[model samples]
Target: MFDSATRRELYEFTRGTEKFYYTSGDAEVELNDVVYEQITISRSEIKNSSDLEKDPLEITFARDSKFAQDCLRSALEENVYVKVIKFQHGQQSILWQGRVVSVKPSGASIVLKSETNFTKLGRAGARLKFQRTCCHDLYGNGCRLNKADWGVQTTIKSVTANAIELRDLSFDDNYFRLGMLQSAFGVSVGIESSAGNTVNIIRRLDSLADQITSDADLLAYQTAVLELDQTIATRDALDENDPNYEQDFADAQALVDQKQEAFNIASESVFFVVAYPGCMKSLTACDRFNNTDNHLGFAYMPEDNPSTTRNA
Candidate 1:
């Protein structure tokens, strides 16, 4: 067994070595092959805390490239997951893992803030499940709970870290019963599903749990496929003076004239937006794998467990 001081020294030595990996979402985690560019790790630590007031970890880092910036930005906007790992001399450990909550500009660099996935579960409008989470709760040690004699089946419409949106309980005494259950067990109200198969359990995808084995090859798939946005209309019908005019001066004017004539003739054609959802590996891409397509597509993945709905 490695001593505590020896482990600390090993970690310091590894920091001075070469590089680390930052992957988005819970995909395949490997020591090699899937490694992206070498990243600079500034600060990383996990503090053991039984004290309720303090967080169990403190981690922060900076990525100088625009690709990293874009990836981090997309993660923050979509609430996607991210992880940083280091491997050396036959030993590897996860340095930090969390959902990217914020990405901000710091001078010429980009700053990323990742909180434990549980923290994201606490955000307003988060979906909740009654029985277990996608992966183990980082701070809660998987939030493993034994079934007790008492059981409650409450529909959780929404949740924040501290509170949950429950149905049918507010008017009835079930709310008080829930509060009593919380007081007795010190468990989060939205942790587990009941044994009966009546209500819908919350579905969560946690990439960090040992029970959840993700396909390594599929994990590398990155792209956030945006919903086909008809939000912006095609500019084919725009006049030169139109604010949304996209074509050149002559072409725009010609199109406007054509549109007017077409309207008089009752044209059967409908204009389609030629916009292609942006792809990564482009000049504007951050990490090649961190793009809008992957984030949007991930939403369609089936829930981790079968107790709840398949695709929500």
Candidate 2:
């Protein structure tokens, strides 16, 4: 209760299955044997507003704290749920709940900008539209696709700018287009296109870039590229009239593929799981997933509005 003199504030930050508990006190607080580490944490006042603009809660953590380091490492882009609780004696009551929308690193502290459910409700968008494509989200209620069936577990083979190569995917090219690539640490990147084992991401993944930059195999890929080029050049110089030219060219091509495969395997250090996104078109829904029955699109919808169209 607010009237209690012994009341303290407890903060809980959650990202996927991971949770961090902290308290703004002189020492750590133990509740049910779980320790909430003492940290310099504070949040802005929650307010009510009539406008649609978000009323963000700015939560700050000490720059040097372990939680701040975690935030910098991966939590900046991921959705982190924040809960504030008022604790007195052995009782606890939730004071605020929200999901982090953005993060700012100040000179002395890391600040998280978060918003409540009301912000989502106030967002400007029609809930549904009269379009030819499906209105439902992939793997959502109306789509009714099993996400687990579409997921593929693989390791990072290499990364070049916004493109990432994973263990060879047997699926056809563009199978993962408009899909998601999630790292073992829960950082997710959107897939723009996929071919063979390589995926082109919609945006740069800073966390993954940092990891690949320091990896020892970064140089290995460069060396592999040079070796592959040399092999191709040697194959191209072969004379067609020579008796052993065919065998020589085949051997050279084989070596190139082998070297490239080895290079991909050598660079494997991090694990990632990718899943294919559902198609919005009715024809794709039927041809790809054989899920025409659950298709939410109005494929036969008229191009012109019935109410507005008239014979000239």
Candidate 3:
């Protein structure tokens, strides 16, 4: 029920050593108290947005209990869900959901591993396609999406010259609007700002060197890009000869591409465009789909419908 790619990604996520309790209905199993070798469990999450995997559980236990063996085997066949609860000082703190991936006997121990529901859904729903209009397609076409699914919720505390302070900050709540955006530019959740014919574009300013409006501004933008490039350069110097060098290089290029795109977007307005906030952009790298970062580009807003720009 799990794919090799999903397994590899999850295996990497749960490398560190930790101890937790395994729970399923009325059954609660105690884990190793002092790094016991026979009984072990590891958990982690897969690192993708659309294909985001869930935290999986890997268990290695002694084959002394027939009940344990029977339960694991039954769960694997029935595809039952299990909860991994983390406790601190005798108080439960974190909870994770997973399904049995494998249950096999190895010598004196029963080796069992369960994958997170996230990965399970990804694998099971891989062929299941849900057709819908994206923000990129329906940005100005009056096709609105439920903001609670995409936007975050946070409270505005105070606005400062350099930064905006927020209270009760929460992300991924869709209903929450950036307080600083609302305070400074009258931007709120579900509200679209009209460019109102005042919006104009500055073409061909694709890179730091190309966006040189003034010597001072040019120096500033160039310096910022140079600093970012230097960090990437340092990483490349350290890991260029590694096995994953090509993948690392691609990731770095994607980052540089994102930065350049941001610079180009900012060049549209003297201050900042109401419709073109960098925060609105999707920052994650989608390597499985062609290493593409889905976000606002030069042709994001249509020339005909310039007024409507806010999208989630």
Candidate 4:
């Protein structure tokens, strides 16, 4: 508000719930009670071409700044969204808006390369294919499964480099394979496999250890389900006289009954993780999900070549 001709810029960078605000002025600026720290930040020209090609925006930050340090520590990367606002003549207007696509760190500064949403619009969508596996995304419209019904809120018993041990869970082993585990701190990680209550993660979350505590809770979502019916069937078919049968099939039936009962009685407040039966486009999988009518795959499609016949 000092001079009508005075100009300054505000930079807002966000990824998930993490945010960084900076202002390109000698003094700090406060908007909506949130302070934007004064920092050495600048941006490249915003270009719009007649051919509908939006030029990428490059924002440079001082190499020793918090933003640059976050980038180097792998906290902020290509997933970040950046918005630049220009304040001139006592008015504020959006200068540029885009997502960070790449980062380049030099000796003195770090430059974030971002592309506008128009670049995403120009990309092609995935084509549907006639495959044996269901093409529908988990919890997606085609899958017709509610994610909320398949998730459980549980406390973290312990944490390791590549895994997290959850508190006592009633679900069976491998129930959360290919699923998602979100920590209370909003850090979501892909589950590689789960045994009992221990969940192995696909990648290490750097900030998870610092953000979680003994009482930290996590939301586990069952994205892919293993075929438990097959296991039960195999256990049932085992010979009574087999030496290992008793040990191998111990509590198998009881475990199934326990899981089914839990599923039937599960509620939002229940700490137990409800198990989904299976994943795939097979009729058995569809039956397990109890959504056979919504199955998106062509399960009846002929697998053999019509033009050639082979003897078995």
lDDT of 2 by residue, 118-187 (tens): 6778677535676667666566556677877878876676789889877758888888887777765665
- Best-fitting candidate, scored by TM-score: 2
Question: TM-score of every model?
Answer: 0.28, 0.51, 0.24, 0.47
169-216 in candidate 1: lDDT tens per residue? Answer: 323222132121121112221222221211212323121111221233
Mind sharing the TM-score for model 1? Answer: 0.28
lDDT by residue (1-312, candidate 4, tens digit) is 356587878999887688888998988887778788998998898888755355889889876575664554343323688899987876889988888877777656778888887787887754678765566655656678886777776656666998877776677676677667766544455677888878887777555565443431222112111234555676688788888777767767676665555444332222332322235456556676677777766655654776553221
lDDT of 3 by residue, 93-152 (tens): 335555557776666566666766667555644231222212232122122322233333
Supply candidate 3's per-residue lDDT for 265: 53
lDDT of 1 at 282: 24
- Please report the candidate that would top lDDT against the real structure: 2
**Candidate 4 Cα outliers beyond 4 Å, as residue runs:** 1-85, 96-129, 141-144, 206-288, 299-312
- Residue 284, model 4: lDDT of 57
